[model samples]
Target: MSFEYYYITVVSLVIFIVALVIAIIMNSRYYKVIREYLVQARGAEAKGQAMSGEVEVLACPRCGYSTTIPFRVGDYVGKVVGETCPKDGERLVVVAIYSLRPTEYQGS
Candidate 1:
């Protein structure tokens, strides 16, 4: 082969190798990020499961409207008193009254 042809072939091979290396590095980084996110999600799910065991169901004292809200072990959920009820248009005070067993966590 001519010198020009040999040089072109060598340059093409070098470019191909460089491109392959770059693609591999980028894919590895992408995989790493995906793995990290999955790990974090699993950890969050476990924590949520532990927390779901302790829930508080609150009811409006004036109107008897009720809702279940999540409560952590050391945290307190504040009550909103004298708030207007969406259903009955009456002023109500919310009071924490009960707890339920754990449920599955639905990630948002």
Candidate 2:
């Protein structure tokens, strides 16, 4: 009957709204946890930890002018990406990689 169909539709609408509200609340809580974690990590960095950075050596094959760039994600030695050489305006190559480790602090 028409009345039975109308009742089911109303119940379904209410259930959908409830699910949407719960999902939004869960998403907000997840982001709040992530923000807290980042805050803690930044505090650790301020205490002189995580100061060293990775170094990259990129060289030009045409003119032999090498460049150093801080290594990041998706960058590695010997993988040629589209980067122009600053010295000779030629295609550059990643020649070497190194990690810049900070020296131990002396209790002076």
Best by lDDT: 2
In the range 7-59, model 2's lDDT, one tens digit per residue, is 99999999999999999999999999999999777757643332466667789
Query: Highest TM-score: which candidate?
Result: 1
Q: Scored by CA lDDT, what does every candidate get?
A: 0.64, 0.77
- Model 1 sits at a Cα RMSD from the real structure of 13.0
TM-score for each predicted model, relative to the true structure: 0.48, 0.43
- Quote model 1's TM-score: 0.48
List the lowest-lDDT window of 10 residues for candidate 1. Answer: 97-106
RMSD of each: 13.0, 10.2
lDDT of 1 by residue, 5-78 (tens): 99999999999999999999999999999999998898577557545465555466556886454553543445
